[model samples]
Target: MDRLSTRFKGTKTYLTNAALEASVNCALVLEKPLLVRGEPGTGKTLLAEAIAEALDMELITWHIKSTSRAQDGLYVYDTVQRLYDSRFGEGNVHDIRNYIRLGPLGGAFTADKRKVLLIDEIDKADIEFPNDLLHELDRMQFKIIETNEEIKAKYRPVVIITSNAEKELGDAFLRRCVFHFIDFPDRELMERIVKVHHPDIDERLVNQAIETFYQIRAMQRMRKPPSTSELVDWIAVLKSAGVTNTQLDQNLPFLGTLLKKEQDLVTYADQLAGGRRWRS
Candidate 1:
């Protein structure tokens, strides 16, 4: 099977993992929704963006929220607005399409060309939402009750769904999708990612930064380990500050970039003060 080994145009980051590459390709070939689950900051969302770029497809994203309903992704009917407009003798009030606004899923299904639909943070929505979405995902079609119209896909869009594992998805919903889990990047992978983002950064500085980053991530007490994106941010800051060495002892000043939680910060600080030497 073909792999998603090419660089994404928007991010210029290549997905190096063979499993991830194969899963993405499988989704494309089978035209099934790709369900990606991973820890926060592990590039789950970025994977969707990369797939869209790789295939040269337009990306339509539905960012799921706690209050998001499955219907919100298909279409929304504005009955109240239509009523008000009818009273005002509005020109388009009689047209059902005027009151019917297509949501991200609906838009994707109706697109003239194949596109990428990113359903981000699917776990944020209520349990029922995924089950509700299953039919449309399988059939690539939905009905608008407002107009009694059936909207079908002109070209099936590539669907990428991301979950941070905040809640367990129903087995029924899981069965419909091609699933994959993205693990945190290893040292070599992390280095490649850093270089992609910061091509001009010094190699010595990159090595030192990775070393220090791993040390902090290895801390058992850290409530939230710094993610690859955070590491990139930290390295960008270090590059700007001209930090030549990994100066583990004096690295406290840059701790804010790596560790976001206050408690995590305190724990790391304590570790540094306790004469925890940075190993090269």
Candidate 2:
């Protein structure tokens, strides 16, 4: 945390501050999990990565998806596959137990030393999933059935959970952690973002892209507007392809980088064909 440059209120810097300072404070005094919420592409998951890097902690990230189950994170049981194999090979229950593959949660809980655990995108996961994590998260440990013993960490792992607000999580789950919400950065800070991600882009092009980005976002076309990532990618694509606003050809194929929707492409093409500025 002390190692991170706090001069900028940019998204990455804000996340770094929140993740490291919050986790260190929580671990020392509060002893709570950290829950981070933001829009997609706002760098919620990256917080743990930056924290682990700054503190020299090993990072273990488990991306939560629609089909993710509570037990899926706890342990990966391969007994079914083993049982099928034993029908052809030597038949034994011991071999099946031996083959049970440990999943991320089991591995993390059982592994020695502290680690940064990232439960990325809890909002996308099943409704009951977050609630089921309470016991394991609170205890900072879990029990593996095969071993018939509890796995406790000498140094409790820093747990960073990210949610995109796609859906609300249970109150029981949200109550378990210290929370942080990351809103999008302002223009000046966003320009710094463009600079951070596309350092080699021309200043004029960067500024133009940023201005156009805000304009397009304001339009709020049928599809969701482009994000900070798209703006950076747009600039990078422009520079790499040697495109200026004037060259025209270089910007056509890469409009997908700038505009993320079908209607947006049509709208942009219409604006370009009409020689319009696309001002809001």
Candidate 3:
């Protein structure tokens, strides 16, 4: 193994390519966030977990959604809770610090040891969301508005952001990141990944199943192709059903495990009737 591979050999459950390893190394050395883009199920979110495991650091994840705001990653003032407390005279309501709550980013910043922060599906938020984070991410510090307290990182955490390309990110945000797009794994890489999950799987079954899996994915009409996770699940189903290598292509046993969409199933069945129409 080369230096990069040796350094980030990936966890037993997660495997990475040279380009991805190099990109991660670049981001670490440059002290910049690594922006990862790929199709859903390409293991984009899992990459952060693997990094944290490999480096023996804590992992903090901020899952972004349509309603997510950039400031939510840093802090949130619990004004409602404070109001309820003040009405009930439950505690000291005069101190605004009592209502201040640190978010994932803030927790990472205040941690004594280095951590890994995964900002998953950043593109799900508004287009300006990424831009709004530029200042704090760049400076590795932020001011808590409620408490007027300055929170700075004791150790800069490894930041990894994932995007499913739901929306276009800003140019400025893109510039600040060490970007890498994770291509879907090819057959060879997929085999290795499968073996990681199913070490005791039969060799012939593995070969036949992989060939069939690729055949299903090759269907241009498929709305959502089966991903790596689905393939692993399908393999487990096959093993449980006592399926043999020769039985795989005969009727595509346990088709539901591989093809999730109804339309895709209909398409495959039609194609099968037309003498394996997916072959091209």
Candidate 4:
């Protein structure tokens, strides 16, 4: 049982949380999909890529959309294209595989070697999509209806499924997966993350920026608190603009970098202006 902590240390992205490390390792050992629920910018999707890089495995990613279907991850039959080809004599109309495009799940299953599969933002898909994936995920095989062929896994893929928790997942679907929730990193962890991207940044500037970052996050009225990535971006912008500690108070123009929502910006501006309380 290789601990993810040891394996993932050399990866580009750093996740120091002990519980998250354990969950990843457990999922790998059990050969079950890891269901990762987290805030939007908590690196849930990046975990899969980092694992693949660390383990030297190929990464297959399926980014789910609201319109995405479970079968879209497995395969998509181009019936209309086949019909058009048949009329125009463009491609092989008789061969079913010609029209069948192998999707992320299908590619992972049929690969000669084990790979890492990232099903990102699974909650974006329809409610039934997760349930629809249960059988194939359990068996590591999927049947291609048009070709009447079964594609089985040559090696069990390392599956990492991420969700933002926009909707509740079905109990039956959740039962089959090893789950982990990634909370926002603490101040120390956040500093390390920021430093990873900005090694040469001034300590004073970093401290001041981080202090302000958390202050904004701690505010009760913020509709969308800045995430780790935004903090990194804000720091990068500050560094590029040669922002100094003394300049921090006078020039908070980069609030746009940290705050995404217009409402958040307006409220924070009010706070800066010494307004009694947040408006909306």
Q: Which ten residues in a row have the lowest lDDT in candidate 3?
A: 1-10
The residue pairs found clashing in candidate 4 are: none
Better of 1 and 2 by TM-score: 1
Off by over 4 Å in 2: 1-29, 85-92, 95-97, 220-223, 246-253, 265-280
Candidate 2 residue-wise lDDT, 1-280, digit = tens: 4323222222444333444465545643455678887766767776677767766679998899899988787777677777776787755656545666766776677677667788888878888888888998888677767757666766667788888888888888788788887767678878877777766767887776677677666653336677777777778778888876623433554777766678777766655566444464
Candidate 2 weakest lDDT stretch, 10 residues? 1-10
Q: Which candidate, 1 or 3, would have the higher lDDT against the true structure?
A: 3
Q: Which residue pairs in model 1 clash with each other?
A: none
Question: For residues 28-145, what per-residue lDDT tens digits would candidate 1 score against the true structure?
Answer: 7788899998778888888888888777889999999999999999999988999998999876887888889899999988888889999999999998889999899999998888
TM-score of 3: 0.91
- Candidates ranked, most accurate by TM-score first: 4, 3, 1, 2
TM-score of 1: 0.91
lDDT of 3 by residue, 24-135 (tens): 8888877899999987788899899999998888999999999999998999999999999999999889999888889999999999988899999999999899999999
Compute each candidate's TM-score over C-alphas: 0.91, 0.78, 0.91, 0.91
lDDT-superior candidate, 2 or 4: 4
Question: In lDDT terms, how accurate is model 2?
Answer: 0.70
The per-candidate count of clashes, in order, stands at 0, 0, 0, 0
Q: Evaluate residue 13 in candidate 2 and report its C-alpha lDDT on the 0 to 100 scale.
A: 41
